[model samples]
Target chain A: MSYELYYWTGIQGRGEFVRLALEDARAAYTDVAREEGDDVMSAWLDGEHEGALPFAPPFLKSGRLVIAQVANILHYLGPRHGQVPDSEAKRIYAHQLQLTITDLVVEAHDVHHPVGAGAYYEDQKTEARRRAKEFRESRIPKFLQYFEKALERGGGRHALREFSYVDLSLFQVMSGLDYAFPKAMSRHDVPLLRALAKRVAERPNVAGYLASDRRLPHSENGIFRHYPELDA
Target chain B: MSYELYYWTGIQGRGEFVRLALEDARAAYTDVAREEGDDVMSAWLDGEHEGALPFAPPFLKSGRLVIAQVANILHYLGPRHGQVPDSEAKRIYAHQLQLTITDLVVEAHDVHHPVGAGAYYEDQKTEARRRAKEFRESRIPKFLQYFEKALERGGGRHALREFSYVDLSLFQVMSGLDYAFPKAMSRHDVPLLRALAKRVAERPNVAGYLASDRRLPHSENGIFRHYPELDA
Candidate 1:
């Protein structure tokens, strides 16, 4: 059966990470929410759907099991789709790296919602400006350098011995950041990560997916947003 | 060999989640950083140690493998320590619940540092107040209600089929929230979670650990900090 991926319709958001993996694996799947309005996704969030209850979206339904959390969804998909190795140690290592990416993603989202998600961006713009400065100066470099080092340690190509789902997610992160913080990212030096993103984008399936209508562009509606005042 | 857990000293922070699992299972382990010093943990973070490098502490060095991320560490420890069942399906379910708890924990920390981690709480007091209000009004109850529903679905006592690592983490979260926002939590309704916390605390092994000096008190230094103004 084709995997049923459920997330909000408009923005790529966290759901893109799952889409990238499925796309790269050439796996058959349906973007349920995008195809059939968000009411379908809302029903799942309201606990109308069966199986595990997700606190938020970007959940995947494969057979009877439904999984939430981007890293958790990727962890399950990695081995099954040949995105990660079979070894237990390697799998957990890949998950650890993915979790680090999750941390950075949260920070990226918080830059615009610094006062809290309940408030509008316009109301929190002052706070976002302060938080974004620190994110661009310290947080971005720290996380990017860590990924660069991990890529180096894993053979300067893939994040592990072989190209895995992590590289795909990293590819998404680098792309989102570039779109969101072009000026700030231009000043940073992370050659290995830059190269990995380039390699991931060139892969046949990923390249095809990127050109298709399936891939959504980044905007203020998503986690990584472009606010000229918030970037360098 | 006994597990060597590394985390920052003084503050229970994220490391306490790993510590709870070990204590509940009565597993032999050393709180390495607390005993040795921050230098040891810093060296590991600085890539001076072997195996996969950690983004931050609360990493466990078990024989040849070093694991990071609280949920990932618990996913590894749960089965071995008899904290979770043997089935892969049940284990992943437990991990999914733990990941939800992880989300709440991050928001709890952000309440006091809404402007970013680089600034001091005093420096960001204005923003923190705004963030904390929304956290108390919405985020806290929303997460607690989800856990309450989860507990009800899981047979009303533990977070899963049996007393697992997820339950232990839930207990920690309940206690931490109560410590950080007593006034707000008092007004909220989460009977199942409150009862679950009590039951987890009364567990023989968990009880013994809590009574000892090993369990640290909550304060401003950790994630769940109580600033009177931030509470209801």
Candidate 2:
């Protein structure tokens, strides 16, 4: 049976991470919201469907299991799709890296919606300016450096000994960061991550997905937005 | 063998979630930073150790494995400590609940540091006021209602069919919220969560831990801070 993935039908939000893995593994799955409508995703959120309740979207339904939380979902998929190493220790390490990525993603999103998600970016422009400055100057460099160091430790080829979901997610993050903060990212130097992103982008499946209509472009509506005022 | 938990010395922060589970399970573990010093924890962050580097502290070292991220650490500990159900489905449900708690915790912390963690709360007092208003009025109730519903689904006493780390973490979150925003929390009604918190506190091991010096008090230094002006 094909897996059913439920997320909002616009600019690759958190759901993109899942899509990348599914595409890379050549796993047969349905992007339910995109194929149908937001109402289908809303039904799950409203508890009209079975399985577990997700606090938000980007949930996966594989058979009877309904998994949420990007890292949690990836953790489940990584082993199944041969995206992680066999050893338990290495799998734990990959997850820790992914969780750190999750933290960075939250920080990146908060730059545009610093005050609260309820308010529009125009309303919170001033707060976003303050947040964006910190994120660009300190936070981004800090996270990038960490990932670069990890990549170096893992032989500078993949996030681990071999290709894993962490590499795919990192590619997505690097892509998002490039879209969101071209100016600031240009100043920071992360040679290993740049190469990894390049390699991930060139992967046959990923390259095909990028060239296909399935891939969505980043917009102001998504987590990683290119706000000229927010970018230094 | 005992586990070595490395977190910042004074504040509970994210480390408290792990601490609660260890205490509840009566697991042998050392709050390493509290025992040794911040330098011991700083060494791990600096990557002087052999294990995988954590982006920050609140990492647990067991045998050769070093697990970071509160939810990830709890996921590891829950199974070994028998804090989760024996079945895979139940454990995943428990973890999904824990991750939701993680999201709520981040939002709660951001109320004080909306601009960025690099700046002081005093410098961002005006921003905190705005963030706190949304947090108290909207975010907290939404999360509380979700947890209450989850609790109702699992059987009113626990976050799962049996007592698990999710319930323990939920108790810690409720206690922190009460300390942070007593006025706002008092206004919202979540009978199931309130009852679960009370029951968790009465657990003999947890009650003992609460009375001991090991459990730190909530303060401005921690994730959940009570600023009278930010409250109400």
Candidate 3:
């Protein structure tokens, strides 16, 4: 059976990570919210689903099972789509890397919504400036350094030396960050990550998907919003 | 071989979630950072470890494999300790619940450090107040309601009807929240979660561990910090 993904229809956001994997593997899946409406995603969140209820969106349904959380969904997809290694040890390692990416994603999202998720960005602009400063100066460098080191350790190819879902995620995150913070992310500094993003985009299916109408553009409503003043 | 857990020695922070599972299963493991020093954790984060490098603390090392991220570590431990169901679908459900708990933990932490992780609470007190307000008013109720609904669906016993690592982590999170937000979390409001926490604490191994010196007290440094002004 084909997988069914539920997420917001407008922006890439977290759902893009799952979309990249599905597209790369050429897996058959439906973007439920996009085809249907926002009510479908809200209905699931309101416990209208039969199985496990997700706390948030970007959840995947496969046959009888439903899974949420971007990293968790990717973990389930990785092995099934041959995106991750078969060895248990390597699989777990890939998960660790994916979890780190999740952390980075949260921080990226917080750059705009620093005070609280419930509050509007305009209300928290002062706090956002402070948070974004720290994110751009320290957090970005630290996280990029960690990934760069991991790439160095993994022979500077993929997150695990093989084309795993982690690489796809890394590519997506790097692309988002580049779009979000064009000034902060220097090509000279994050050479390995930049190269990986380029290579992943060049992949047959991934490239096709990127150029296709199926790919959504980043927006202020999404996680990686490009606010000029917030960028260094 | 015994598992080795590395985390901060002081407060029962993120590491406590892992500790609860280990203690509940009566698994043999060493609190390496507590016995050794913070240098051990720092060294690992600095990529001094042989295998996967954790972005932060509370990573587990079992024989040749090392795993990080609280939810990921618990996901690995759940099946190994029989805390999760053997079925793949149920196991993934347990993980989805655990990841939700992780989200709550991060939100709880952000209540204190809303502006920046690098900045002190005093430095971000204004932002903290705003963040804490939203957390206490909206986020707490939403998360508790979700868990309450899950409990209702799972027959009000454990997160999955059976005693899984999700229960252990949920117990830890509820306990921390009680200590952190005595005003926000009332017995009348979250009866199911309150009962679950009570039942979890009454477990033989868990009770013994809580009363033992191995159980660390909640401090200002941990995720769930009790700032009087922030609570109400």
Candidate 4:
């Protein structure tokens, strides 16, 4: 049975992390919200249909099981798709790294919506500018340094010794940050991460997906938005 | 073998979620950082020790296996301590709820540190005020309502049908929010969540721990900080 993924359709937001893993593994899945309208995603959020109720979208349904949270979804898919090691210890290690990535993602989103998620970006531009300054100056470098050190420890090929979902996620996050803060990212030194993103993109299945129409472009409506003022 | 939990002293913080489960199960574990000193925690963060490297603290070491992240630690301890269901699907569901709680905790922290975690809370008072306004007005109510609806769906006892680590975590989040924003939380109506918090507090092991010296008081340095002006 094909896995069914439900998320917002317009941009490569949090859902992209999960999508990248499925595509990298050449797993057959359906992007439910993209095929069926936003109403279907809204209905699940409203609890109109039943399984395990997700607080938000980007949930996966496979047979009788449903899972939410990007890391959790990847955790389930990792071993099945040969993206992560089989040992219990390595699995936990991969999860720890993924959780840290999740932290970076939250911080990235907060740069734009520091004051509020419900408010418009125009309304919170002042606070966003301040938040983005700190993000570019401190957070981005610190997080990149952590990933760089991890990559070095793992022999500079993947997040672990071999290719894994964590590597795929790191690639997606790097791409998003590069798109959102081209000047800042270029100024910062993250050679290891940049190399990993290029490596992941060249994978046969990943390259095919990126070249195909299934991949969505980064837009302002998503988590990583490029407002020129926030970059500097 | 006893578990070794490494976290900062003086504040419940993220470590409390793991502590509550260990305490609730009457499991034998050593609070290493509290017993030792900050140096021990610092060394781990600096990657001086072996095993999987954690980007930060609140990591657990069980024999040769080491795990980090609050949710990941709880996910490891839940089934081992009889705090979660045995089925894979239920375990995944419990994890999803715990991830939601993690998201809420991040928001609570951001209310005080809107600009950057490296800076002092007093330095970002202006941004804090704006962030807190949005948090108190929309984020808290929406999160509490989501938990309330989850509790209602689970028969008003726990986040799941049975007592799980998710319940322990929900209780901690509610207590922290109450201490941080007594005025705002009191004004908001989250009857189901409030009731669940009370229920979890009354559990035998939970009550014992709360009455013991191990239960640290909420302080300004922790994730949930009480700044009166921001609350208003």
Instruction: For residues A1-232, write the lDDT of model 2, one tens digit per residue.
Output: 7989999998799999999999999899999999898888777777777768888988999999999888888999999999999998888899999989989989999999998998999989989999999999999999999899889889899888699999999999999999999999999889999999999999999999999999999999999999988888
What overall lDDT, based on C-alpha atoms, would model 1 receive against the true structure? 0.92
Assess the local accuracy of residue A136 in candidate 2 as a C-alpha lDDT between 0 and 100: 95
User: What ranking emerges by DockQ with the best candidate at the front?
Assistant: 3, 1, 2, 4
Regions more than 4 Å wrong, model 4? none
Which one wins by lDDT: 1 or 4? 1
TM-score of 3: 0.98
iRMS of each prediction: 0.8, 0.8, 0.8, 1.1
Q: What is the fnat of candidate 1? A: 0.80
Measured with C-alpha atoms, the lDDT of residue A146 in candidate 3 is 91
State each candidate's clash count: 0, 0, 0, 0
Cα error, candidate 1, residue B68 (Å) = 0.5
lDDT of 1 by residue, B12-111 (tens): 8999999999999999999998898988888778887767889998899898998999999999999898889787667777888998888898999999
The candidate that achieves the highest DockQ relative to the unseen native structure: 3
- Candidate 4, after superposition: displacement of residue B39 in Å? 1.7
DockQ of 4: 0.81
Docking quality category of candidate 3 according to DockQ thresholds: high
Give the distance in Å from residue B18's predicted Cα in candidate 1 to where it truly belongs.
0.5
Candidate 2 global lDDT: 0.91
